[model samples]
Target chain A: MRHNLVLRVVAKLLIPFILLFALYVQFHGDFGPGGGFQAGVIIAAAIIFYGLIYGLDAARKAMPDRVVETMVACGVLIYAGVGLAGLFLGGNYLDYFVLDHDPAHGQHRGIFWVEVGVAVTVSGVMLKIFYMFASRGRDPE
Target chain B: MALTVIVLTRSRNLFTVVVLAGVYSFLMATALVALDAVDVAMTEASVGAGISTVLLLGALYLCKSEETKPVRKPWLPLAVSAAAGALLVFGTLGLPAFSDPAAPIHTHVVPRYLNDVLRETGVPNVVTAVLASYRGYDTLGETTVVFTAGIGVIALLRRRRKQPGAANKQDAAK
Candidate 1:
């Protein structure tokens, strides 16, 4: 793998585009067919591809384990926090209508934040699973 | 697809099986697109064809490349699967026809959602509006589940590095 110049060069060229596409799917979801779940998986796939071509150590450096672990929790916190905000804004739990002065705008804002939360959590979960399986039975350096 | 499944079942080589599984997933994703479920297709392609294959290959690296033949004939398991399949097929007998306008789903909350989604969420994508707004609580629960699963895997796999240096790595991971 180290001696494979073609794979290394091609992957280097392609990873950024893959990540950009994932972001497109994440943010453009409101107007199209893509969404957080698909975007998150695509993002994780980009990192996984990097790991496959470069090395798991390199991928870990690109996205530290501690940061990924926190992301997994923080995403859920963001989602639940939105729900609490709704409750405090004179609405039922998870009521997006109370997020702003206009109910429609509130719904838009709520959906945006919720989708972001979903994307982060999903990407973190995928990376965690990859790390676990990849590191299994390997001797520690 | 059925032939692929048969080949997958007969093959004892885990590598071939895993690769075939990815192929199967791609086929399934294509089928979903044909059914106009583009989002589901995207998810299946990414998670099923991409990540699942990589994870399966990683698991294979930790163990035998070939599957050992089971000693038993597995008749009980076969009978159970057959019974489950029969039950599922029987259950579908009562379901409304595909795309029927009078179907329970079409007649129920579907109309309301279709009528009000744009006004309610100010999002042109009805699917996104439904998933993130109408079903916000459900999505929150799903996010929680994803977070818990990540934590569970970390707890299961990261605790096994018993060396002193590994302990330092664990602290850093924290």
Candidate 2:
């Protein structure tokens, strides 16, 4: 992999675009046919592609094991926290209508955070699984 | 697509089978898009064809490439599979035709969601409104499920057969 100049150069050129596309899918999901889950997978795919081309160690350093592990939990916490926020805001559990004066805007705001949570957790889990598989049967640091 | 499946089942090499499965998933994603399920299509394409294939290939690296021949005749398993497939097809035969105007789904909660989603949530995509807002609890549950699965993987991998690094660290510290 280190010797393949073509593969390395092509991957370097493509990764940023792949990441940009993933972001598009994440935010544009409301108007189009994408959302948190799709975006998360796309994000993981880009990073996984990086790991494949560059090396597993490089990918792990780029997204450390501790950070990846934390992500697996943090995303869920963010989601549940949003629901708790709704409860504190005088709405029922998971209610979005009361977040703002205009219920529609509140819904948008709620959905955005929730989607962010989903994307974080999803990408975290996907990367975690990849790391686990890639690191199996190897010496650990 | 059927041809891909047939070839997949008949193939002996695990690597070929893995690649073929990815091809099968890609074709399935195409069919989903043709049915106007673009969101689901993206999911199938990315998760099914992309990530799962990569994971399978990774697993393949840890094991033999060729499958061992089974000693059994495989007749009973084939019969059971054929019976299940026939029963499933029979079950679908009683369902409404594709895109029927009066299908139970279109007449039921779907109409309400479609009519009120934009006004209620101000989201142009009804699917997003339904998945994230109207069915927020379900989506939260799904996220929790993913979290649980990830934790489970971590737990399984944490307990390694050997802890040479732990021993080495302790020795160096002492």
Candidate 3:
């Protein structure tokens, strides 16, 4: 019971800030100590906190297994698809210079998409691991 | 530090042991950050304090919490661990200093990324540029790790279904 309350209050307080900070890291990584990977873990940690407090079922209700699975696949797909796009644009694999006429712009576009992919995959993995561990016993409630 | 280690060693509670281990990890992470390895420090902080703690707690749930009294000296394992630690520190002495301008790590391909990645990639974040573009293949592997973990979770948590005849019989009785 105490765990539940702690989880609830912590989740409510931290999830929003975690998400906001993720965006900040995503955008301001060059100037700070964080990047997509760190932000992704932070977001996932928040969700995992929710799972620990509310039980696996409630957590699943909040973030369905299907959605998490799709996000995992989609992240990889998005990353590969961007590289393939560069291929179509007549460049080498992951060659962002050909993404647009302006090579610099292409690089920015490529990095943005890839970071999005990282964020998706990392968060999905964290939540999935939490779900696996949390669902391990018979109904204890 | 030695005193804390003695206290932790003397404690006979597994919960206290795990908590102390976490504190130790946090201290190690602090040292890493102070040494200017922010990326490694961040990874350690998340994996050590966040995920490992949760996993350890789960394992603790399925086990007796009390620590059994020591029956034998763990001298061999202690000696091996100490030797490994000494070897690691010794190895580092031969390596370049952190952020050294002339270090091979700083002078090689890394300089290219630091100097030109922003200008070439038009991305304000050079780390993102390197992670997403210059080293995309590595990122792909990282993503696959996540994909495998998700699948593993589903496999582990999937519920077993009752046999059709059993379910039908139960329904008829109801």
Candidate 4:
């Protein structure tokens, strides 16, 4: 794979667009056929593609293991935090209607943040699984 | 697609099985699209076809490419599976007909979501509105599940690299 110039070049050209498309799916979920889960998997697929072509070291360098671990926790925090915010705002748990002054606006804001949290957690989970499996039976550098 | 499934089951090569499983996922995704479930189709394509294939391939790297034959026949498992399939088919007889306006789901829950989703959530996608707003707790729980799974994998796989001389340090890291 290291000697395959065409593979390397094509991956280099494709990775960025794949990431961009993931972001698009993440944001456009409310209007389209995608959301956090799908977008997260797509993003993970892109990162995994990079790992497949360039090696696990490069992928790990791009996203450090410690940071990935933190991401896995942080996403759940964000989601629960949003629910706590709703409770504090004089509504039931995860009540998005009370998130902002205008109920509709609050709903939009809440959904957006929740979806973002989901996206982060999903991508983190996928990457963590990939890393664990990929590193198995490998000789440490 | 059925042919692919048959080939997948018959193939002894793990690599071929993984590849054929990916093909099955693509076929399922296409079927989802044909059924007008685009969101589900997208998820199936990305998670099932794209990521799972890569993950399975990574796992394959650590294992033999060929599957070992079982010592005993699989007649019991096959019979159980057939019984479960028959039970499921029988259960479907009690279900409301497809696309029936009077169905419980269509009559009770879906109408509220479809009618008030845009008004309340200010989002055009009812699915998103329902998932993120109406079912926020469920989504939160799902996120937590993902987090838990990640933690579980890390716990299971993240062995401390034993130093060449300090073999005792592995327990300390754990």
True lDDT of residue B61, candidate 4: 91
Worst 10 residues of 1 chain A by lDDT: A132-141
Q: List the residue pairs that clash in candidate 1.
A: none
Error of 2 at A19 (Å): 0.8
**Deviation (Å) of A64 in candidate 3:** 1.4
Q: Could you give the DockQ of candidate 4?
A: 0.89
Give the per-residue lDDT digits (tens) of candidate 4, residues A68-134: 8888888899899998999998999899889889999999999999999999899999999999999
lDDT of 3 by residue, A28-119 (tens): 75556666677778777777776776666777998998888788778888888888998999998878889878988888777777777877
TM-score against truth, every candidate: 0.94, 0.95, 0.83, 0.94
Give the clash count for each candidate. Answer: 0, 0, 0, 0
Measured with C-alpha atoms, the lDDT of residue B72 in candidate 3 is 96
- Residue A36 displacement (Å), model 1: 1.3
- Assign candidate 4 its CAPRI class: high
Q: Tell me, per candidate, how large a share of the native contacts it keeps.
A: 0.94, 0.81, 0.67, 0.92
Q: Report the lDDT tens digits of candidate 3 across residue range B12-87.
A: 8888877877787788789989988776688678777777787677667768999887699999999999999999
What's the C-alpha lDDT at position B64 in model 3?
Answer: 91
Residue-level lDDT tens digits of model 2 in B121-155: 99999999999999999999999999999999899
Using Cα atoms, each model's DockQ against the true complex is 0.84, 0.86, 0.60, 0.89
Look at candidate 3 and tell me the lDDT of residue A56: 69
Ranking of predictions according to lDDT: 2, 4, 1, 3
Better of 1 and 3 by TM-score: 1
Clashing pairs in 4: none
Error of model 2, residue A119, in angstroms = 0.6
Interface RMSD for each predicted structure:
1.0, 0.7, 2.1, 0.8
| Whole-model lDDT per candidate | 0.90, 0.93, 0.77, 0.90
Docking class of 3: medium
